[model samples]
Target: MALWSGRFEQGVSEGAQRFGASLPVDRAMYAQDIAGSIAHARMLGRQGILDAADVERIEKGLLNIKRQMDEGTFVWDLNDEDIHMAVESQLIRDVGAAGARLHTGRSRNDQVATDTRLYAKELLLSLVDGNDALRKVILTSARTNFGVIMPGYTHLQHAQPVLFSHHLLAYFWMLTRDHVRLVAAWRSADANPLGSAALAGTTYPLDRAYTTELLGFSHPIPNSMDAVSDRDYLLDLLYACSVSMMHLSRLCEEIITWSTTEFGFITLSDAYSTGSSIMPQKKNPDFAELTRGKTGRVYGDLMGLLTTLKSLPLAYDKDLQECKEGAIDAAGTLQDAMACVGGMVATWQVNADAMRAQASRGFTAATDVADYLARRGLPFRDAHEVVGELVLYCERRRKGLEDLTLKELRSFSPLFDDDVLEGLDPEGIARARTTYGGTGHEAVKTQLREAARQLGRDRRQASSLRGRMPNVTGD
Candidate 1:
C-alpha cells in the first residue's frame, strides 16, 4: 500500500502508481536510507520525542532491514512508491507500532534530502579515489615513456616536437582539476537537511544537531524551506561528472587516433581492443571509442537534470522526483568509464620507436631553426623569411632541413651554421625548451615531482573526507 493511503479515497491504477514510483531509481540508496532512519530514531530518543523502548525497537528493526538489503534478500514492491516508503513500510511490518512511530518527527522531504546528500558525499569521495587512480596511471605512463619524443599538434597538424611525457602530463593536469571539482561537490553535499520535516519546521522538539552529528554532516542546513527543496548538490556532482567525462573523451580521442595504423604511436591491449567480424586484420580501440561516445550521454545526464529543475517553485515538488536518476546514472557512468580508461592506459604498449620516428616530420624543427637564426643577430622576421625560403629549398630537392649541406644552408642565409644543423635533431629541438612546464626533458621531471606531491596531498584529503562518513566501519 501507498504511505498516504490513509488520506486517499481511492487508489490509482497500477500503471499510474508505477509511473509515479521512484523506488527503482532510489533503491540504489537503501543503505543511506536505513542509516538516516537509525540516526533519526536515536535523535528522537535523545530529544525525549520517543521513549527508549520504542527507539530500541526502531533501531533494531532498521538494522534488520539494512541487513536484508545488504544480503540482497529485501523484497521490493511497486506500491512502495519510493525508498523512504519502502523501508518505512517494511520497518512497520517488522516491528509494528514502534516502526510506525519512527516517522513521528520527520517527512520524506527532509528524509530524502538527507539521504541523497549522504549518498552524494560518499559518492564524491569514491570519484575522487577513482580520479586519483587515473592520475597515478598517467604519471606512471609519463615516467615509463619518459624520453620518448612525439610530434605535438595544433589544429591537428604537426606544430612542434614534444616529449611523450609532456603529452601525458597534459591529461594529468586536466584530471587534477577534475579532482578539485569532485571534492567541491562533496562539500556541497556535506550539510545535513534532516529535521526540516516537510517544508517547515515541525512542532516536535527534534534535536537536529544530534542527527547531524550522527550522520557526520558538517552542519545542519539553516533554513527549513531550502532544506527539503534544494537539489544543488546533485548539480555540483553532475557538473563535475560532465567535465571529467569531457576530459576522458579528449584523452580517448587521442588514444583512438594514436592506435590507428596511420599514427601507430601506441597499441591498445588485446583486452581493451576488439576485432571486426569481416576483417581479421582489424583490432579496433573500441573502449576508447566507447569512452568518447559515453561523454555525450553524461553531458545529457547533466542537461536532463538542469532542464527538470529550471522552472520549479519553492520547497519540494514532484519535479524533484525527476532528480535522482540523472545523478545516479552519471556517477555510475563516470565510475565505469574511469575504470576502463585507467586499465587501458595501464596496460597499453607504447610504440616509442614509431613515436620517435614521426616526431620531427613536416618541418617540425622549423621553429628551432628560426630560433637558431634569431639568436645569430639576424632580425627575427628576416630569420623567419630565411627559414621559410630554406624550407622551400629543401622541399624542392625532396630533402629534410637536416639533409642540407652547410654550403646549401648558407646559400639561403648567412646565419646558417653547423649549430643550426645540430639543432635540427628532434630530441635536441624538444629538449632545447627548458622553460618551466615546457616539453623539455628536465622540465618534465620537475613537473613529475610536483605531480607526485599533489597526488599525495589529494590522497590524504580524500581519505580524511571519507573518514567523516557515518558508519565508515559499516553498521
Candidate 2:
C-alpha cells in the first residue's frame, strides 16, 4: 500500500501509480535518501520529538535497509512511487511504530529537497575531480610539447605562429572557468532544506541548524516555500555541465581537424580511433567526433530543465518530479565526456614535424616581417602595407616569404635586409613574441607554472570539501 493511502477512499489506478512513479529515476539516490533519514531521525531524538528507543529502532532499521540496498538484496515495489516511500515502507515494516514516528515533523516535500541537495553535492564533487584530472592531462601535454610551433588561427585561417603549449593552455583556462562554475553550483546546493516541511515552516520545535550540521550543509535554507520549490541549484549544475561540455566540444573539434589528412598535426591513438567498416584505409577519430556530438545533448538537458521550471508556481508541485532525470543525465554525461577527452589527450601522438611544416606555410611570418620593418624606422601602417604587397608578390609567384631573396624583399622596402630572414624562421617567429601571455617559450613556461599552481589549488579545494562531507555509512 502507498504511504499516503490512509486518507484515500481507494488505491490509485494502476496507470496513475506507474505515471507518478519516480522509483526508477530516484533509485540512484537511494544512499542519499537513507542518509538524510538517518540524520533526521537522530535530530528528532535529540529534540525529544521522538523517544530514544524509537530513534534507536528507526536508525537500526534504516541502516539495515541501506545495507540491503548496498548488497543488492532490497526489494522494490512499483506501488511505492519513489525511493523515499519505498525505503520508508520497509522501515515501518521492520521497526513498527518507531519507523512511523520518523515522519512526524517532516513531509515528502522537504525530504525530497534534502535528498536532491545531498545528491547534487556528491555529483558536483565527482565533477570537480573529473575536471581536475582533465586539467592535469592538459598541463602534462603542454609541458611535454612546449616550444613546438603551430599555426594559430583566427576565423579558421592561419593568423600567427604559436607554441602548441600556448594553444593547449587556452583550453586549460577555459576549464579553469568551468571549475569555478562547478564550485558555484556546489555552493548553491550546500544549503539545508530539511526543516521546511511541506511548503511552510514546520509546527514542531525542529532544530534546523542541528540537521544542517548533521547533513554537512553550510546553513539552513532561509525560506520555507522557496526551499521546497527552488531548483535553481540544479539549473546551476546543469549550466555548468552544459558549458563544460561545450568547451570539450570545441577541443574535440580541433582534435578532429588536426587529425585529418590535410592538417596532419596529430594522430589519435588506435584505442581512441576506429577503422571504417568497409574502407581499408580509413582510421577515424570516432571518440572525438562523438564527444563533439554529445555537446548538443547536454545543451538539451539544460534547456529541458529550464523549460520545466519556467512557469511553475512557488511551493512543491507534482511538476517538480520532472527535474531529476535531466540533472542525472547531464552529470553522468559530463563525467564520461571529461574522462574520454582526458584519455584522448593523454594518449595522442603529436606530429611536430607536420605542425612546423604547416606553421611555415600560409605566410604565418607576415606579422613578424611587418614588425621587423616597423622596428627599422618604417611607420607601422606603411610597414603593414609593404608586407601586404610582399605577400601579394609571393602569392603571385606561388612562393613563400622564406623563398624570397633579400633583394626581392628589399624591392618592397629598403628596411629589408639579411636579418629579415631571421623573422621568416617559424621557430624564431614563435619565440620572438615575448609579451606577457604571448606564445614565446618564456611566456609559455610562465603559463605552465601558473596552470600548475591553479590546478593544485583546485585539487586542494576539492579535498577540503570531501573532508567536510558527513560519513553516510558507518564503516
Candidate 3:
C-alpha cells in the first residue's frame, strides 16, 4: 500500500506512479536515513514521547531492516517512492505500534534533508583528500624537475626561459584555491535540519539544538521554512566539483600536449595510454583526454540543478527532487578523475634532456639580454629595440643569440660586453629570476616546502573529520 494513499480515492496511474518515484536514485541514502531514524527514536524516548520499551522496539526494528538490506534479503519496491517510506514500512511491520510512533514528530522532507547534509559533510572531506593527493603528485613532479628549463610562452610564441618546476607549481596553487572552495561547501552542509518537519517547525516540543549537538552540527538551521526547502549546500558542493573538474581539465590538457611527439616533454606510462588499432607506433594519452572531456558533463550537472531550482517557489517543492542526482554525479566524476590523474602522474616519465633542449631555442633568452643592456644605462624601451634588432639578425643568419661573438654582439649595441654571453644561456636566464615567486631554483624549493606543509595539513584535517563524522547522530 502507498504511504500517502489515505487521501486518494483511487490508485495513481502507472505513468504517474513511475514518474513520481525517487526510489531508484535515492536508495543510496538508505544507511543515512536509518541512522537518522535511530537518533530520532532515542530523542523521542528521552522527551517522554515514547517509553523505554518502545524506543528499544523501534531501534531493534530499524536495525533489523538495515540488516535485511545488507544481507540482500530485503525487496525494494518501486512503488514505495523513496527510501524513507520503504524503510518506515518495514519498521511498522517489525515493531507494530512503536514503529508507527517513529514518525510522531518527523516528515520525509526534513528527514531527507538531514540525511543529505550528513552525506555531504562526509563527501566534502573525501573530495578534499582527493585534491590533496593530486596536489602531491604535482609537487613530486615539480621537485623532480627543479633545474630543468623550458620555453615559457606568451600567445603561444616563445617569450622567455623558465624552470619547469615553476610551471608545474602554478597548477598546485590553483588546486589549493579549489580546496578552499570545498571547505566553504563543507561548512554550508554542517547545519542540522531534522526538526523542521515538512515545511514549518514541528509541534512536538522537540529540541532542535539538542539534535544539532548530538549530530555534531555547527548549529540548528535558524529558520524552519528554509530548513526543509534549502538546497544551497548541494549547489555549493556541485559548484566546487564543477570548478575542480575544470582545473583538472586544464592540467589534463597540458599533459596531452606535453606527451605528444611535437612537445615530447613527458611520456605517459603504457597503463595510462592506448595504441591506435592500425598504427603500431601510436601511444595515445586517452586517459588525459577523457578527463578533459568529462569537464563538460560536470558543468552540465551544475547548470541542470541551477535551472531546476530557479523556477521553484520559496518553500519546499517537488522540483527539489531534481537536485540529488546532479550532486551524486558531480562528486563521483571528480573523485574518479582525480584518482586517475594522480595515478598517471605518479608513474609518468619526465624527459629532462628534451625539456632542456627546447628551452634555449627561438632566442628565448632575449628578455635577459634586453635586461643586460638596460642595466648598462640604456632605457628599457631602447634596450628592447636593440634586442629586437639582434633577434632579427639572428633569424636572418639562421643562428642563435648565443652563437654571436662578443665583437659581433657589441656591433649591435656598444653596451654589450663579454658578460652578455652569460645572459643568453637558458640556465642563467632561469636562475636570474630571483624574485620571491619567480622561476629560480631557490623559489621552487620554498614552494615545495610550503606545498608539503599544506598537504600534511589537509590529510590531518580529513582524518579528524572522518573520526568525528561517523559518530554524528542524525538528530
Candidate 4:
C-alpha cells in the first residue's frame, strides 16, 4: 500500500497502480534521488527535527542502496509507485521508525524536482562534451584540407568559388550557437527546490540554503509553487537537443549528397558504410541517412514535452510524469548521433580532385570577370550587363570565360586587357575574395584560428561546470 493509504477506505486497483507508476522511467535517476534524500536527511538532523542517530542510520542505509545500485544488484519493486516509495518503504523496514522520519518535512513534489535538476545538469554537460568532440573533428578536417577549393552555393546553384575549409566552418558556427543554448539550460536547472514541501512552504524551519550548499545548487528557488511545478529547464534541454540534432541532420544530408555518384565529393569509409544485400556493387552511407531520418524523432520529443507542460495548473500534476521520457530520449539520441557523425567525417576521404573539377564548370568565374570590367572604368550596372552578354556568347560557342582570348574579350569591352586573365582561374578566383568571413584561403585560416580558440574556451567552461555538479560527499 502507498504511504498515504492510512486515511483511504481502500487501496488503489492493481491496474491503476501500474498505470500511474513513474518508477520504471525515473529509476534511471537513482543516483540523483539517493543523493537528494541523503542531503535532506542530513538537513533534518542539523535543524534538530530528527535525532542524529536516526540521520546516521538513514545515511548508511541509503549509501548501501546506492552501492547495490552501482553493483547492479538493487532489486526493483514493481508494486512501488515510484523510486521514492520504494526507497522509503525499504528504509523503514531496515531501519525502523528512524527511516520513516526521512519524509517528515518534505513531499514527493520537491524531491522529484531536485532529482530532475541534478540529472539535467549531467545530461547538459554530456551534450557539451558531445558538441565539443564533434567540433574538434570538424576543425581538424578544416585545417587538414585547407587548400581544397569548392563551389559555394546559393539556391542549390554554384554562385561563387570558395575554399573547402570555409564550407565546413559553417557547421562549426552552427554548433557554437548550440553551446549558447546549453548554457541557458544549465542555468535554469542549477537551482535547489528540495525544501518546497508540496505546494506550500513547510513549517519545519528547514534551512533550504544548507541543503542547497550540500547539493551544489546555485540557489534555493524562491517560490514553493513554482519550485514543484516548474519544468522549463527540461524544456530548455530538449530544445538544445532538438537544435543540435537539426544541425547534425543538415551535415548528414550533405554527406549523403556528396557521396553520391553524381557529386563524388567524398568517399565514406567502409566502416561507416554498408553494402546492399541485393546490389552487388553498392557502398551506401546508411548511417548518415539514418542520422538525417532520426532528426524528426528528436523534434517530436521536444514538441511532445512542450504540449505536456502547456498551461498545466500551478504545482505538480500527473501530467508532469509525462515529461521525463522524452527529454531522456532526446539526449541519448543526440549523443549517439554526434558519435556516429564524428566518426563518419573523421574517417571519410575527401575527393579534392573531383571537387576542384566541378568548381570550374558552373561559370563560377562570371562574377570575377564582371568585377574585372567594373575595375577597368565600366559602370557597375553596365559591367553586369556586359558579363550577362558574355555568358550568353560563351554558352552559344561552348567556351568558358577562361577560354576567351584577350582579342575576343576586348571586342566586347576594351577594358578587358591581358591582365584580366590573372584572376580568372579556379584557385585565383577562390583566393581573390580576401574579405573577412569570405572564401579566400587567408580568410578561412583566420576562421580556423578563431574556431579553435572558441572550442577550447567552451570545453573549459564545460569542464568547470562538470566539476561543480552535485556530489554525495558532505562537502
Clashes in each model (backbone N, CA, C under 3 Å)? Answer: 0, 0, 0, 0
**2 or 4, which is superior by lDDT?**
2
Better of 2 and 4 by TM-score: 2
Error of 3 at 329 (Å): 0.2
TM-score of 4: 0.97
Better of 3 and 4 by TM-score: 4
* Candidate 2 lDDT over residue span 316-368, tens digit each: 88999999999999999999999999999999999999999888889999998
Of 1 and 3, the candidate ahead on lDDT is 1
Candidate 3 error regions (>4 Å): 470-475
Q: Order of all candidates by lDDT, from best down to worst? A: 2, 1, 4, 3
lDDT of 3: 0.87
Off by over 4 Å in 1: 472-474
**TM match of model 2 to true structure:** 0.98
Candidate 1, 140-181: lDDT as tens digits: 999999999999999998889999999999999999999999
Query: Which lDDT values do the candidates have, in the order given?
Result: 0.91, 0.92, 0.87, 0.91
Off by over 4 Å in 4: 473-475
Best of the candidates, lDDT:
2
